[model samples]
Target: MDGVSPKFVLPETFDGVKMEITGQLGMIWELVKGPVIVPLLQLAVYICLLMSLMLLCERVYMGIVIVLVKLFWKKPEKRYKFEPIHDDEELGSSNFPVVLVQIPMFNEREVYKLSIGAASGLSWPSDRLVIQVLDDSTDPTVKQMVEMECQRWASKGINITYQIRENRVGYKAGALKEGLKRSYVKHCEYVVIFDADFQPEPDFLRRSIPFLVHNPNIALVQARWRFVNSDECLLTRMQEMSLDYHFTVEQEVGSSTHAFFGFNGTAGIWRIAAINEAGGWKDRTTVEDMDLAVRASLRGWKFLYLGDLQVKSELPSTFRAFRFQQHRWSCGPANLFRKMVMEIIRNKKVRFWKKVYVIYSFFFLGSGQGAKGNTKGLKKFPRIFKLPDRLNTLELGFAAFLFVCGCYDYAHGKNNYFIYLFLQTMSFFISGLGWIGTYVPS
Candidate 1:
């Protein structure tokens, strides 16, 4: 081999040297097989068991709550009523109050126009609406696009302003803080924040503004977000279902139970005064929205969850983008736990059950049987362990019931529920592995 060319040969001076290329290759192969593989295989087994347990646990909890609510708690007989404004009323009277809509952008050139157009077309008095393009784009192309869009809106008599900062100090949070300091938004009554990917309906303000108007004590109103292109792929469809579960069931249930609910960052309106009173936005955690919501709620500020109003946003269509989003969410919760859990527990204003839910929500950070289950795949079958077979028959029955219900919800539209469930279970296994992938050194 050496006679062919020196270039193709190992250095002659290092001839006697024994290099552990195989060892390095073995390390690489260990990623595919070794302690990591062993645990992952074990995790797969435990995941099946834990999933069964979780199924049972959720069903029992939900059943108990339902029975208690029905037997003891009196259901509110309140009915929703819509009252449209009269033409005779002063345009300034009930028509339009000062509303500052803040659109936060970061490297979102692809959806910039759609977001801007949707915002500009909001059905509100032009004079009363102040749209601030809070652009923190490091890319010149994105910056130019934002400027041009702002100019176009200005020409059309829309009160839109473009803002750019030299450096992104606190990322999205910093952009918002700096924008708030600007005199333009100081006197604004309410501020609506939208991420670059969100395209709110024209009547979003018309629908949500009244809640703030009628309820003076309300600090924020969060509208449900719907994905516009959810049917684009299997990944997006699953995401849409997950989001539906969150907004429709979890958020509503939490709000109705007077438990802690969070601002989802975008598609929400905050009273400028309420934001100021809650100490404005802070950059201590990656989930600035959640941090602010919790701080404000603990500070005696009330939040309204507006179920009727909906804002449309794009879902991450690829597994890569979805994984990135989930990773950030997971890390944000971890960071929040580090920063605020103790303070939350110590707060006298938060209710006991709310504290429990907060604790439960933060349990995702624990290295428990659940985490292990989440990290494994079923492909390594036979090794897949059943969650403790010692669970009482009643517990197993309850688990089966809950599993069926969750499966029903997830497979509502599918013609073959079993296939759908299998695919979904596999996708989750893969995604969970992706989550664990974050901890691996590159």
Candidate 2:
């Protein structure tokens, strides 16, 4: 007992070591503490999670609906044969409807030749078909080349016109509207539009025009896009799969159910009357095509999506192009939704279910547009973390559940899981920032 009382240094050292460890752990917690508002940030995180869940549910529903349609629905009498339905007598007759093929271009030098060449090759009566090349190119070289190409096609016995404006007032949509103003177009019965990058098959008009001709109520017939550069890179491949899911599953379901889906800005044939009836093309919004489609649909016109009539187009080969495209997509829909939603609600023509779907579709359409690495509202997001970081066990568990779901999805062969993961991770940054920026303002 005397010896033990004489040496208690070990116990003191042990207590000192314990205090040091406690201090280090406190420092670690402080580091994770980050900015304050941990609770608010956690709430924001949960809200994001809820949005993600909604997104997932919508996708699942679309997939199921599309699959069921393909499996159980009767294959209608729709034809996909490349052989012209018109027999020899009808083919020879000059009574075919006047069709104007419009190629909207804006410095699209890379793919202009392919598109113009393809348009010239469209199998329609030589006199009845008018190829209008709307060249809004600012580049003198590109403009000259485009004009020369139009000349070359005209020399080949094709009725082609190269038109330019003093100024690109509305960019692409402006040029298209201006083309429609020409005296030549007034006689055209229908207008087939293709972006500069799209190359429709020779049967493009043959397959799509009949729908408009036979069904007077059909306003627009849109064809599915098949990416020409899908094999060029992993990004393109990812884009291809995503677009396929959209066209095959979502668009098909819309077609089967008569839902209100908009035109893809290209590869569509529009009735001249329908275009005029729907208030024509207005450049108030950047997504003039979708705006026109929605307006036309609201005016009791129907849209037909032909998944079989594939339009091969080049995907934007660079990330910068893809990003800008995405940004435009997100913003345009939001802008249109903002402008037209009240009209949609007040309109008597839209069915209740259709209205619901349209609202839901565009809300997410705008929301889903903002994603990873976009610097929009990048500053506002960090302020939510201004509170001390306090870990919420329940929320942490929910996050872990998401993690498991992602893992399960990857295991189940959605190799595009990487894309989903990247989007989800950046959703709070980009998506949340967008909503806050739009609604909350400065």
Candidate 3:
């Protein structure tokens, strides 16, 4: 009797309670879905569309400004005190400014010799020119090879030094910084940087040095990059086109209007005084070049970009390498913006418009023109209807117009131009995905 009594009946109410809770939750979601969730999503879409329009407007505005400037812009020689250096026999080799050529390498086994040879072959006085090979290769074999190459150049009476460090503390930035600390470099009036892949002409020094030598106010002389392997693959060809646009339009505009542009990290010469005044290179971000340029500009230092004086360099051939390169190019600027926005705002040396240009036009947008387009395609293209149809049509029109202009410029008789145009279009779509690929964890 006690055992039977202990087996009390359990309430069958659990299923009913869960069903009631789920029904209430569903109702709540429906209630908030229209007013709260939908509006929030619509607001996000609107914001994205607005950003896209702003970027598009800036692109167009810059284009117009470039055209107007080219109409009557004074050449550097006209504005600055540019006197061509006479022959060594006439002017004397001792009168030339001492230059420190720094070639930074990191396991670049294939191109080290080319860069070293090109630099040593520069048409400058042997006594006045100092070539520094900053080899930060972790691979011992690569390090040995680079050192031997430097020694080989040294045997030819070239004043080239082979430099190594205990560790790659700041990566490329640290190596460059250390290279400047040498006792011999103190004698140098200017410093030129070359990446491992770059091969400058023998007269590179003869042409670029005059700008820095003549213009005391100019902090840096940035040269254009010409890709040696642009025809190697479709990826390389696309990169060539994108970079061509950057050097041709953006750099030219910056140099002409603001007297400023990002130091392209290599194939550029920096006055030693300007480098010290800007506090040298800091490794706070991956983009040491842009960081230095910003700091230097804030200190009232100006930069010059010579579009005609192009230095030959190799582009990344593989997708994996290209992805990493794009990640650095895209993310580093954002990171630099985050760090330097306040500094830029507080600087009194630069004018108000210069500050605006740096923050709004340079860092906020990006060095590459394609990033904004790519970003828009990724974020705003799907929900583009959040904005007016007219706005979308305007952007499409601009794109189509640019395409037509490019065809007119390059597609006269060359069939390769057609292939290049198609590759560029393909490049745009694929690079748009990089916005996602770059940030996502590998």
| Highest lDDT scorer | 3
lDDT of each: 0.72, 0.78, 0.81
- Single out the weakest 10-residue window by summed lDDT for candidate 2: 432-441
Ranked by TM-score from best down, the candidates are 3, 2, 1
Error of 1 at 20 (Å): 22
Q: After superposition, how far is residue 56 of candidate 2 from its true place, in Å?
A: 2.2
Model 3: residues with Cα > 4 Å off, grouped in runs: 1-28, 88-91, 367-442
State the TM-score for model 2.
Answer: 0.75
lDDT of 1 by residue, 163-254 (tens): 99999998999999989998877668999999998999998988878767766777888889988888776767767887786776556655
**Worst-scoring 10-residue span by lDDT in model 1:** 367-376
**Using alpha carbons, what is the TM-score of model 1?**
0.69
Count steric clashes of candidate 1. 4
lDDT (0-100) at residue 86 of candidate 3? 58
**What is the C-alpha lDDT profile of model 2 across 6-50, one tens digit per residue?**
358888989999999999999888977776657778889898898
Clash tally, candidates in order = 4, 6, 0
Every model's TM-score: 0.69, 0.75, 0.79
What is the alpha-carbon lDDT of model 2 when measured against the actual structure?
0.78
Greater lDDT among 1 and 3 belongs to 3
